[model samples]
Target: MASGGSKSVASILLALNLVLYLVITVIASWAVNHGVDRSRETASRLPIPARIFPIYFPIGNNMATGFFIIFSLIAGVVGATTSLTGLHNLSQWNAPNLNAAAVSSFTTWALTVLAMGFACKEIELGWTDSNLRTLEIFTIIVTATQMLCTGVIHVGVSEAPSITY
Candidate 1:
């Protein structure tokens, strides 16, 4: 509802989110393309141990894992725009009615996911000893910011596409 009536804000937010997500994805992809990336090499060397979803979610969830989740995060946001939940408040779906449930639920769910994904930090080691954990948290924050920015930018706008971001 926020930026739906105005395209400028929505586009700007989307572009920004995409850029941030791309930075992380590109770095991870490069690491996969080369032997320089540690996760890829480890996964390839010991494929058996990488089957667990959570453990394997980040590095190779699909985009190549160490960064694959970033792509999924993108997909999740983009998908929400087109999902049934998003359409409930759109002019295309409800010519005039604006049920609060859809908006509330969608907003709540989106924010919750973004928060969880953004602030995720499963490991608790000495701050100085957990470089990768720190990096993961950093990525989560970047991804979360992108998602949150994209999702909330148009919350009060009218008739604009409800982006999952």
Candidate 2:
């Protein structure tokens, strides 16, 4: 594909990913807050094993829910950051900028995939709220979008004419 084509594709994907990541961040933050509050209320009444674990989520898919939420939060933040970097790179439209954006986008995609794995686990465990289910769907979608963004950036970088010192 032409550099212009790649840039447009990356821009669109980055925008989409940014919005999805922000949504994930907000929902995950709410879930974390809810989980903490519930855990605090039941802390004293909880059993030894439950009390021992620092991150205990009383709702959703039990243990897997906690992992999923944490990872989703991480991925959301990283993905947002990656999107910002990608936007900057798009504005510049150079090999170095594209490379940097590609690296960050790849990292964010990996984190998103990790979160998606936990999402799958949470799904398998069952019993999740509507917000969590929404989060899972977004995470899965972002994983693919992020990968596409990274791939497009890399292709753009590679296709650019080499600079001689």
Tell me model 2's lDDT, rounded to 2 decimals. 0.87
Candidate 1 deviant stretches above 4 angstroms: 1-6, 33-119, 122-138, 153-165
Estimate every model's Cα lDDT from 0 to 1: 0.41, 0.87
Per-candidate alpha-carbon RMSD to the true structure: 8.7, 1.3
User: TM-score for every candidate vs. truth?
Assistant: 0.39, 0.94
- Kindly give the stretch of ten consecutive residues in candidate 1 with the minimal lDDT sum: 121-130
Model 2: runs farther than 4 Å from truth?
none
Residues 115-138 of candidate 2 have per-residue lDDT tens digits of 999999988887788889999999
Q: For candidate 1, write residues 1-165 as lDDT tens digits.
A: 334543344344445544544454454344334423454455565556453323343232232333334443443444334233333433343323233423433453464354344334333212322333433554565555545543543343445334353
